[model samples]
Target: MTMVLCIGHPERSPVLPLHPGARYYAAPSPVGTPGGDGTRGRPWDLATALAGGRGGSMVQPGDTIWLLGGVYPGRFDGTLTGTSAAPIVVRQYPGERATIDGNLHVHGAHTVYWGFEITQSNPVPNANDALETYGPDCKFINLVVHDAGKQGMSFWEDEGTSELYGSIFYNNGTHENFDHGVYAASEGGEKWIVDNIVFDNLAYGIHVYVGSRHPFLSNVHVRGNTAFNTGAISRDGFQNANLLIGGDVRTEHMSADSNLLYFPGTTGRNLRLGMPRGDNRDILVRGNYVAGGAVTLLMNGWAQAEVVDNEFIGAGTIVDLTARGGSIVAHAWHGNTYVRDPGARAWRYEGAAYELATWQKITGLGNTGATGTTPMTPRVFVRPNKYEPGRATIIVYNWGHQPTVSADVSSAIHAGTRYELRNVQALLGPPVLSGTYGGGAIEIPMAGVDPPRPVGRTGPTPALARTGPVFDVFILNRTK
Candidate 1:
């Protein structure tokens, strides 16, 4: 069946492919009467369209609800359930804007809500989240949630995988309420929080507070987001942070990488990775640029994490390992650059302030330098392609000011295997692969131009070393 697609503000709304046998309903409030059917020509109100009575059929799995441009009030509760293959989609109408001056509650599984603006108009005392989800496999994408009384968005008490992508959560929480920008607490599920911006909250910018209700939170990935100006307000002498991972729970394979966190108003830690009761294992915090906090990173009790290839600039204490409580079995601090104020200690270990030199000598860690400005270290990860069986994708991130010269690929490939690189020129400007792969340890040349510095900087700035180019290498086996 042919459909008429509208186009104006493409990012606010995009044309979605119609699922087979799925029904469509439209809600154009402030213009459409309540008695009309939910058709494109004669749309219904938000309540009638969502409740699905006189103007529309009941919302079912694989259904699509199109919200036209207008201000909608009341909570948009997700009471309808859907499957993984065919999810219930609630999206804005193309070329128009939809604003919800209320809250949202998602109680159903496998649902998606995209491209809307959620804000608080009345400003109630102790107000709930602008968007709160307790369902599994639910996704919130490209939405703006701001100025809430409490958290901007939350994923609480969920046991299923959820995702939040390309969204903005800002200006949330009150002084008394002490809320966060994004508060996530799941029993056990994977969460992908990527490409978002969170700022200007009373508490943390992003918080993962998993309590003792769950055994573990696994595969939690927080990547490529930006957070700034957090914890400006205090609550009962407890200030917030840029990011906080706390609770009486366990975590596995949790990674926070390539994020930009800065400008903390309080003296709280910029990146607090653990709590007094939680056990975090195999956690990786890498390639992040953090600045303007009293403590850059605080590893509390029962945590074994790797702080690698990150730049921590202008902090009182770059790393604090005093509160670890002797529960850290394995921890590594490698290739991290710290630009602190002079005479400020770089680290605090076991209740004693130590410079980088003293700490490195005692623990045999952080061998890079005393000032913590180390050369760029190359990081690579390879995984087999799910769609194409005989191929793999290589991710190479250069965490320095200079371009990466070569990358070791011994662990990724086998000996005597002939492979061809695809999409090499598109990523790094040109193909620069060299040398034969007998594969005990082979190096691949990756010569790319370094990024140009800012125009008016006199000397070397810390911001210049915080970012570099990243390349993706797609490889196909030619031997078979």
Candidate 2:
């Protein structure tokens, strides 16, 4: 389908509202350093500007700091703080792209960072996160971060309530099972992880699992996200879930809704809620689509919950409530579609196998939902890049495992637009398939493309990384 809303540059989106205050600063540094005054012509370096300038201090709470287009290599620590109503703004120069080839640490609170490419071109000592957050009420929007030794972003639990929205993550966690596309944690307050595309990471995507160091997390809302092809390509050959939350710690009531998950060929489950060691108090899993994995809710599952209107499609045991000793209290497990080969064990409740009709009657769930023999057909969503109309991020779901899927881009670009599609997994490699767009459905080649291989994580990878029909994410740009 043609992208209607996300038709603009992925970096500049959720289109920022007008910030008050009549001040602006510039960082036109050729290198990230501490020189130059804060002026458009003589802009200070990124480090200087973020440190509040040289002579005294030039950055205010609501002022805008523009980093002129170019590569800024090195580590950057930002200490600019702002209120919830008015946060400090650090973004790329208009119409120009900036690439940070190191690490970014947000040490202050209430700031809005926009439009930039943050990567780990220079890996840290221990394969740490490319982006680390320490402040609260901050918004890291419309950014692209990848190539980390560990996670792409460490949305820490220090202050909590930070947002990682409208961003893209891939090719990270060269360190192995330890990292993910997003490593989000929260002890309290609401953490918003919304409308982002995370795929092809070395490990799981949008992971909320924690360890013994700090085992208690609460109030995390993961919504409007798409994750696929996780752990398929790895240094250690481990295929993990597309999306997972909860671990060995105590997890509070959380929700996973309106998301898309697919693990086409891998043994990875599309989505997993809670781990075996953790005791989940309450949970809600609704309106999600899963393929090639079961929606398993692990641990002691006699919790207050609602698992409704979701699709769980896998070869066997499409849905496992993780039911423990007793029935789930205050539960609503209906309107959820289950798909499997006929006669395959389709569901498990309290460790007992049951057919769809029997399970529905016994638990009074899936009464409105139906069992399906087929998986979701392949479909594509084209998101136009606002800055350069020739560039766009295309999201493809190849649930049926078709070698090719087609999409119409007439709304985003016109005819005669010579375009090439390259799987994000191999951006440096030649395009997987390319053709001139005639303003109609164009086929995307999806076969033998996936995440990289690595081994450093402590979490368990799939016993065997399943391999099947492969492509999940791609970048579409105009070709000469």
Candidate 3:
């Protein structure tokens, strides 16, 4: 059972690059100072060295324990088992400094890959939890858990489910007395994908529950990471934003992408889904760039979710979904780009009785004129011509909320003109220009223009033709 290859390039397989610093081995290096052999630079200080006494012994799937940097402080129960074919890793030996100061909390049958820092030298009483995996694939990478009072990195997969990357969950115990940073409870599919994590002063950066498809366990990729100045302290406690993918049992692969979420005076519902019950279908809120916090993305009980291509800046009612007892069925929103309180008016598609013709507006083909209806300020480009490769074309200028600057289409553009476009993903009536004549006395010249309200903007009330009436399409760029 020897399969540790993650390193690529020569042709591609490369991904094995988790050596932030130390890698010293000896003492049989398995657990550390096993029978005292302690070699590779003469290492020995795992708690008091000598492998903490090798408690329940097992750790042998390919065995690899490094921990080398500094400060490793108390109350550390032990047992590091492993074997689903070779899976024991306790990292940090590629460079140096791997610390676990106190309260590792173990029960039995192990698999502990605690990388960097697993802090705790002072406060940890409220509930108490610095680390707990009860045993499963058990992996806690690039770790950095702090102040712990409870749930810094708690996972009880029952049998298997544990994988946290780039961790740094801090201050953990104020929100309601500690909620979670990377806490997974375990049920069916048993999953955890906590990626690029970093939650300041606890209350949730990444907390999943019971299992099922385990919400499919998507990236948890809470990107960029930062929950500064925390929820403040609502009379005695605080902590909200940063991320909380709860679960009473609703699995469909939930995902909160490109994160930078923040919560100042917390209350609740930053990115919550209370669980309520089950059927929590495929949730994937994309490219998140949220700011304040009110109800960034929440969907209560009876599940059915899919909020796509997200970019809800500022945050207020970007998404509420509603589900205490009523609405929320077969939910499907498309091409999201809400930006209300972030700086001001920007609601590409606010929710509440929402049904933009079934959502799929991801436009793009070429000749993007009419500027999505004036206002041009929200800039983001890149789609010159690859005929759509993985698809990504954002031209959201005057964006949503029925305000495309007044839809002018710039008098039908003419600066070397040559069009043949069709990249209009919904929100029709403003960006429709046409003209492809070749000969035959095509003397087209209108005086009081008014006759061309049809390009592509289906159902759900797609009939608002009164903004500037100018039309002159045909801006092809295929050169085919």
Return the top candidate by lDDT: 2
- Which 10 consecutive positions of candidate 2 have the poorest summed lDDT? 2-11
Question: Total clashing residue pairs per candidate?
Answer: 0, 13, 40
Ordered list by TM-score, greatest first: 2, 1, 3
Candidate 2 stretches with Cα past 4 Å from truth are 1-33, 122-126, 157-160, 212-215, 294-302, 361-368, 380-394, 399-471, 474-480
- Model 3 TM-score, all chains together: 0.29
Per-residue lDDT of candidate 3, residues 1-480 (tens digit): 111111111211112223322233422223444443333465554642313333423234445556556555656654555455554455666446666666676543434454466766554343467777665555555466765666676766555545554455655553363556566655533444433334344456566655554443332323333333232322233335456664545455565554445443224445655465655555655555443455555655534555655554433444444443454445555566654432232222223333222221221111111112222232222222111112111122222222221221222223334433332221123324335423221121111123222111121212222111111111122111
* Candidate 2 per-residue C-alpha lDDT over 380-476 given as tens digits, one digit per residue, 9 for 90 to 100: 6566654345766667666677877787666556799888887765655789878788877777766745444334444554443323353366667
Q: How much is 368 displaced in model 1, in angstroms? A: 5.7
Span of 10 residues, lowest total lDDT, candidate 3:
1-10
The candidate that wins on TM-score is 2
Model 2 residue 124 distance off true place after TM-score fit, in angstroms: 6.6
Better of 1 and 3 by lDDT: 1
Off by over 4 Å in 1: 1-25, 28-36, 51-60, 175-177, 211-219, 233-238, 264-266, 323-329, 341-344, 366-480
Model 2 C-alpha lDDT versus the unseen true structure:
0.69
The candidate with the higher TM-score, 1 or 2, is 2
